[model samples]
Target: MERKGESRGKTPRAPVTERDSSRSPKRASGLSREVVVSATAVKTANPLAEEFDLSASKSHGQEPLPVSFSSPPLLDGLRESVLQALGQSASPTPIQALSLKHLFSDIPEWRQYLLASETGSGKSIAYLLPMFHHLKKSELALPEPTSSTISSRSQRAVNPRALVLAPTHELSRQLSSFAKALLHNIKLRVLCASRANVKSTPRATFTASKMAAQFTDDADGTLGMPHLGVSRPVDVLVGTPNKLLEMARGRRWDRVKDETDKQLAAELSGSRSETSSKSPEPEMGLQNVEWVIVDEADILFDPDFQESTRTLLADVAAARGQPVPYTPDLLRSSPETSTTSTLTQNTPINYPFNLILTTATIPPSLATYLDVHHPTLTRLASPKLHRLPSTMKTEYEGWTGGNKDADIERRIRKVWAEDSIRSDFNGKRSKILIFCNKGTKVQSLGAFLEGKGIPNVALTKDSGARNFGNNHHLDGFLRTTNYKPKPKSSSLSEDKEPHVMITTSMLSRGLDFSPDVRHVFIADEPRNMVDFLHRAGRSARAGQAGKVVVFGKLKGRGSAKATEMKKKVGALRK
Candidate 1:
């Protein structure tokens, strides 16, 4: 039989490695003896560096994850249910198998939870499995409905009890679709922040394609609102942070009435004063929200977002004591608002919900902060099939000079010799994703790679019309523009599954790259704990094996500084 590590195909590559510096530090060569030594020392059965490329990852604080791991409660059953729903052909990959459990287990006293796993580890499924269970298994209730007594779509909500937040639009769209598929038989009304414009607004833009729409519709008109939707609440709900914030801040969400969204649209078209002046300010409606999930959690931990989240939580806590967080249009949308103006006159929201967060890689700093703020929060880690094993090759070439761009390119070319390329030129198709620290560096590298005949795509920050190309900050890109949208495209889903996706640190964690992405070339070094988490998590996921190669300054002034940072993180973890 062909060796497990044998090459599967061919992929064009840009020049690799960084520029030559004075001290091209001695890296842990992933050769025979080294592989043996590391394996002997390895604490767990995860793939070793001999098979995975992890020269720069030796210093990470992670404990290798085992193949068989257990989850908390209710989480395991939830995962099993989703797995069954997907069918046998759509089997759970190894990483998914490992991660699904821990992500779901409950922390009874804690108000928060966090997951740290790399891409291709079935991170999405981790949260989805449990959230679905929370909705279906939990006995919840929505607020009430208005307008036509015949009932509306959202009014069917057992009480539209939960809210989920995502960072990017593309991610939001991807997740909404995933939720729909998983809950095909259940009732789940998803209101995305990027919803269809009432007139033409990004905030109003909803992303329910035909099939997705089926899932968004509820048995009652309250499917999308607090009262009807909340009263008859659906099993689940998803939205973006900012958009949800705007909705919560605005008034109007009393109950689901006939033509509810339509009425709100007209009201939104008017001045804010006119909208809020007619109704009470919209606040948190968490009574029915038994489970609240935050996706792309690393991004949410940003100072700006964290502050906003605190405010959001405060709102959810107050919905019971305050009036319905509804707008005038919501009142007009629901004829009942005229009669039931207060919580005393209508259904009151009073209940606690579980909070769950998921991310491919989490920053230790942020994790520390969260722990400090929410003392009882719990953290879980997922396993990786792509480990830094010694059997895999590990080599480094350095460059030094005042002409930064030229030196870096030269170093990259030196490392991209014909030997490092895929063995089969025509049969093997490889995609590479380059990680860069600065936008300027990303631009330079992308331009150079394309110039050198490599079919590559660059994801960068938008510089006010200065530079652009499939760039997505936190609000995710549109799935239509991306090359890889569907997870199960048979064209390239098997062993040779790597696609080159160049990005900043944004694409680091919580992503899944099935069997194809065997080689991980890191142009940037993981400077801190969270950064390290993302880099190390990339290689092996879903039980399929893989490798990762990191190239950057690991010596001299810059490298020394990076070293110090690593040591500090190490001490903290201890």
Candidate 2:
């Protein structure tokens, strides 16, 4: 049976694979001193990496330093399910431990922060805890809506207490998974806008198609319902900007009702008992959101999403003025409590919700914008930008193979040859991640590897879509790290031959790869320092020792741009 909450379309089934016993393990090899020296020419380590002692020190390195708690400080209030989801690894990462201390510290008002941390430093968990903390507290303090100004159902449907905006569908889905874990066994409902329901072309066409589908009673019954803005009950919502706005505009719901209410009322009088008993669901909106988080704020503020982000911010800002509707029972029983000095109607509340923006990189314009809009934002930066993790051994080599395809094929062969030997001797599979600049290259290379009988997959933005191909790209690549294979899939089995993942920037940052990744092959040099850092970050994650190889021509180590980038990287390391 299909899961109750699963969205439309079928999830692709992963392929099966069998090992080739002909390959034998070879002795592990180390980089030559000359190659090591060249690679270090552009290495940069994050200055903040030294701030906290990775071994025994548990306190956050800050003014009001966090006292070492027996366990994660916020674990007490979190649901057991959430804790269970976190499992033994619940101990906070350095970034999470430090950010939580200041973010949740006692203050006069809600705190605003701009958090910059290294990739895979547990940034998601850092903000997620605080969001849940605030929402649980608010749910207790605030009464349910019962205002005659709007239907209780309608108000409840459209009002989301917490809003999280991500740049991509995959990121939003990732956030939704974490949010669900934290909300386990709780009354709250978390909604993630599926990419399938979202339309990007012809605004009018999108509106018409969405509304027509939603007006019916038997709509998919998921969050995608266009009329859901004012009708469905969603406490936490994670989505891309354009899709979010499509579902957030409550006025559209009101307009729908205004046009249909009369006809519906007439039909109710004439219809049979079963039909008459049914009523339209409430329209959805973002009326009383309490927290707004922009994950990957740098991407959210980028040119591609900037306009939609501005519109979303404007909508949330407008929703702020209207207070949360109160239940009649609470009003009658505790008028004084409702109008307490802290929450008095006369005393203006600061902007309706708390704002948190998180990213590894904050562009200058975004910095300027934050300075103006959220002047009080707590500036949190790792002592320096996160450089490559120390656990990774960097390597540089020039590509002597003629032509692009030849260079790529040669590099793949070399890595596979070395890894095969390591696998036989060490009994450990060497998961390799290869980086390419473009999607077509990734696909072509993946196809090429398949032809060579090497297990490989290509992951990109389109890979996450429903109709991109029949292959299960996202599912297959995600399992590469944890070794959790779907039922009857020999390819995902740990005993199966080690698989290689060829990808673009889509899998470069934020997304977690398997700790088993033994090597990262930079088929193409990153364009800049930031790209270099994120690419290198793909390996040596969570303190695991790994290797990184940047290939170039035999005469020259790496591309011209890569050489220049290396110098800047070397300076940062120095």
lDDT of each: 0.43, 0.54
lDDT by residue (446-557, candidate 1, tens digit) is: 6776665544456654433212111232211222212344465667442333234456665564443334445556676654445544554444543445545555466676
TM-score of 2: 0.68
Model 1: lDDT to the true structure: 0.43
Using all chains and alpha carbons, the TM-scores for the candidates as numbered come to 0.55, 0.68
Global Cα lDDT for candidate 2: 0.54
**Residue lDDT tens for model 2, 1-574:** 0011111222211111111112101211121100000001122233322321111111122243332222254545463544455443244454454555656654556556666655655577668777776666667776765565345434333457788888766566656655665665544667676445333222333333234334321121124434543333457777777667766653243245454665577676885332222223323456667788888787677555577776776677676664432221221222223453433322222355677788766544354344333444554544333455666787776656566656666666776567668745374457788888888989888887777667677776676553321123455444121234556465555444546888887676555566666688888766555666677776766555788887765355446665655555554454
Structural RMSD, model 2: 16.3
Q: Give me the candidate number with maximum TM-score.
A: 2
